[model samples]
Target: MTEGNRMFIQDKRSYSRLLLMLLLLTALVSSSTRAVVHAAVKVPDTIRVAFFINLGTKYQSLTPVATLQSANGLNLIWRDPQTGISAGTIAPGQSVRFAMDGYRALLLETTDLGAAIAVLKKVQASSNAAFVTQLTKSGKTVYQVTEGAYSTAAQASSALTKWTNAGVAAGVQTLLSARVAGPWAVEAGSYASAAEAASAAAQLGNAGLDAFAALKPQNGTLSYVVRVGQEKDATALSALQQSVAAAGFANARIPDAVEPYTSLRTDMTLNGSANKPVTLYAIPSGPSTVLRAEPAGSGGILLTERNKRTYRGSMEMSVLNQSLAVVNEVDYEQYLYSVVGAEIGSKWPLEAQKAQAVAARSYALSSGMGFQIANVVDTTTSQAYYGIGYENANATEGVNQTAGEVMTQGGKAINAVFSANSGGITADNAIEIWGGDNSFLSSAVPSPDDGPQKGLLDWYYVALPSGQTGYIRSDLLENSGQTHVSGAKYLRVTGEGTAVRSKPQVVSTVEPVARVGTGTLVVQLGKVAEYSDYSWIEDPMTPDQLLTALNKRAKSPITGPLLTLEVTKRGPSGRVTEIAANGVPVNVGAGDNLRGALNSLKSTLFSVEETGRYTIVDGNGTVREVPSQSGSLQVIGGAGTSGSLPASNAFFMDGNGNLRAVTTSPLFVFSGKGYGHGLGMSQWGAKAFAEQGYDYQYILKYYYKNVSIEKGA
Candidate 1:
């Protein structure tokens, strides 16, 4: 028949007619006619059950098979942990059984009448044994193997025929493919034809294995594989395997070993004290991984479990430069206070502002050093408040005069690229830079003016083979170039030969900032900004400058609005312990004067308790009524100061930062800290901390209360 007519005739047939014919055929073949079988299989509600048989392997992530007795019909459960529950429909020739222990369950699904009859004949013993006796004894084909090398397929088919003739039922398949030899080569098993080996060899070229005639030198032709990349070591490979299994690739295997690279020492200081050593987790190629540490002396806590978040006291922060071991979280906070305090002033409320500043820095650093902290200081008192500091709760008034100007300029340049009504430059937008004479160079990036480039202003420039030069615009350009640069970015040499370093430097990264090339993602990490004339630039290879530039794009906020609550009275003396209504010795800022003290309380109080609310009195046979006025009383302790307060629990904080309230003698009821989880190190808090300078170690020490830092096994 013609191809078109064959297709039409085949398409015209209906499935209902086919089923009717099949039923009539079956009835004619049988001596007596019986109703069409509709075997109903019972499915269980909760399919999770312990097996009576022992599994040789300790763990099987997937349950592929189960066995049950057949009363009216067979009751079987096939649960694929990865795919959830599957019930009904056991078509002939398809496997419903998955792996149990050492055995397989004869799958109930099959459409083949012969195979079904064989399955019915099998005894109720081991599935494999029963299947062999029932199917093999019947002299029929029941399985298949196809789609590999022709030689292998032929061998399988012949074997199947022999088994079938010997009264052992089996199925076989035939496939077409050139026979080639390779187990290691990714393309070893694949082939167009034997004659195409040379072309394949030319294609492979120098990527390790070259195609050879006949899989020559079987021993030498072992597959060459890139087992693991430079990012992993032997220990890491094992962990990676575990992760892969947990991710559902249980059958996957890792290569035995890999070549080593020039390793760098990664020192970790989690929590404040360096006395305790931290275990190193596998490092990724990303910017950095955030870690957390609890209070000093607090017995070691491991944050290695997947998805478990914690605070970090110290970190082995990674940038372009070799990592540096740093000071405690508190010290970092102190350094920030000193810098900002010096920038603003060291006066009455300013001193108190420093404590709050420390708190803010600590909080941000705990999270992850990927956020921006807008510290709004009370310039008059030298005291800094968070959201409500300089202006209102929204910090609308907080503005960095220098940064604002740079932003305005950046906005104009970006508007030129994305078009006029494009709004301002965001970290998600791609930024392209041009060189001298309005020539475009480099691909776009997510954000402009990041970390190291924070202070430096960016502009378009035309790049040359040696370097680049260009003009920056304050207003929208009437005619901007739209031509794209081709090939790898090249710099042009103007006067003297410029020194070429692998990365940005403190000096030169700035001058060439406008000359970013095609592949330049963002300004180099960790270079200092230098300003000259009316232009700002960065050192490309300088680690400091790059870090500074990256920091600019960080919108993840480290410090939240200054938490504050009002208290009617001071703790014991003029010092504040808990709010007047509730007793939660939370972090309290300090100022030099009374107003400063009150301001500290206002900015730092996490939550407050209502003192005027009535307290329900429930006693056994005792009915007593208490006045509503004392409903919210926060108990005060004799010892109270800012600096010396206990890291955890209730502690009196005086103006000098002294920690008092060693024990909770008089219980005080209260609500405090945005989270009942406490201050210093929230896992969310840890990400916040890294945003500032508080590394993982600092976060750990801040939250975990006192213990001891020692080497962990």
Candidate 2:
């Protein structure tokens, strides 16, 4: 038997819920706790991962919480997970659909436009990120507004002043698809009154801590304990202890024993027909319900049959704002095996896998209850944890060899963030990648892959009007060989508002002697702008397109017309440190937010430019020539992003030495290296490094500064 195979287990959406009030599905299971159970500092042996939380754009689609079954040909049982009492059994290949029993959402909708506007305003007043949707009702179009996916009609009515539907909805937000921190918590004293306990929890929460009032029942009286944060290893517990002390709750308490958690009452629909309020498990008992529910299911069982995904451990069903979360509570090492395989592939070099295993472990332990219910989620948002299917002998070897080992810095677990590729140059932890913060991640240095991976350049060396040479993109120069103009005057301005400088470069924005629009004749010039690709690049984002994206994803969206996008600052490796839109510094959240806002850049090490306007398409689906005047020019073709055009127009010069002017429309070209934030260990770089004979220790040390691979919880 494995040494420590214990059975246990963001969306960025504003669809967040109150952490403490989660998992209560009806009056069936608010069972009383005996004591506050002041826990001590200890590392967790099992990890609870919340999986298959399919919440997306509201009401587009909803993924049903599917079945859980055993695949190892072992018999499974449905049980009251809290008491570890078996309620029923699940046969091999059979399924138990965790149907919403007490879980229900009250839907609110109104067809009238005026009513919907008022309803949306009232609902959003309370600070829930609610929105209105135009959907269909009984073949007639209706404008539906909502508050929370309220579990009861009374809650829905209370959210708005008028026109509340007393109707119940089948499920919560219809998501089309499924999509951490230091593990430390501050627990205050228990109170006899739930209200007082909630007040204390809110006090801590208002202090910016993730505070939740836990129901710790005693004798038959309802007592509550104010809990904050999740489990943390001993090394990191000291900081949390001090933080709680500063937050006014000094006595340090962590979950070192049976962790109390809220339970939901879900109907175990076995074989799609019969339903019962039974806790699903294969074993009669092992551990407590909320923390670790040891399921005796066999390996390879179809936990989510619809997705053909299999998982070990037990599945716990709960709802956040009525959105269903199927949490997989599994052993920590077992989870790592799947994560290593899913992240770097099962066939990756063993040393690389080992490095990944240790990194994943450290990352997991360093995270708090990310989903508010689980320590992590089975996604890249936390880390790639695909479940049992991705587990393999190679990955298992990697995990087993590095069992309980994590990367620690200064005797504490570091964040140990890793990416697939670091392009060529790694992002500087203190500046480039996310923003100046991570001196711990300073190990992210330049990485070398097997072959050409990062940015590559190919520029045209051309002679200028004054007989000077510079590097520029070849598109800006085409030798006609047939002198379209006359002697010594053989050039046409391809782009409107093409700034003519004394010297040629990739692009120059400084004061030039003159500026020209499309077809404005000019002699050839020099250049120094860079254009490179990864052989596989995403669709280019234009200035307008990027402007829309900036508005959509930036923390402080450019409310006014978006025009110019320029990289104002960069890190050591030339990754964007700061950016400007229309000369104003953008407030895009650090890390991948800039990349995400700019239409999902491969990485943050990118360059953006006003590459002149591309093919112009107006609102009528017609491509327009360079207009003589410009009030506003919206372009299409490339991602269809919109932005403000240049203020003035460039003039075209005829062969007879006459001049004609036109509009200035420009595109923003983004080019970069790598495929992620470029921080920490590069997985692909690790593979290459491993293949080049670097051991796992060397590989890890290369990416994490002053880190020592050591064994821990």
Top-lDDT candidate index? 2
List, residue by residue over 373-433, the lDDT tens digit for candidate 1: 1111111111222111122211111111111110011111101111100011111111111
Worst 10 residues of 2 by lDDT: 174-183
lDDT of 2: 0.55
Candidate with top TM-score is 2
Q: Total clashing residue pairs per candidate?
A: 134, 30
- State the C-alpha lDDT per candidate: 0.24, 0.55
Candidate 2 per-residue lDDT, tens place, 1-713, comes to: 44343321132222334333454532224332211122232347789886656445421122334456674343322223334322234555555544221111213444454554554555445533333434333334344444333334344445433323322222324221110112234566777665676567666655655454554434433346666643223465666667767878866476553343332122222211222233321110112322222345446546553367877776665444444446777888998988998888677789988989988998998886655667887778789877777889999999898788877766677788888778776777666655556556754466875244334443333334433322334454445443434243345546766554332333344465455456544443223334322222333355667777778767766855555677888767777867887678888777567887888777887776453422445567976433223456644436877665435433334345543223365545565677778788888888888889988888887888766666773
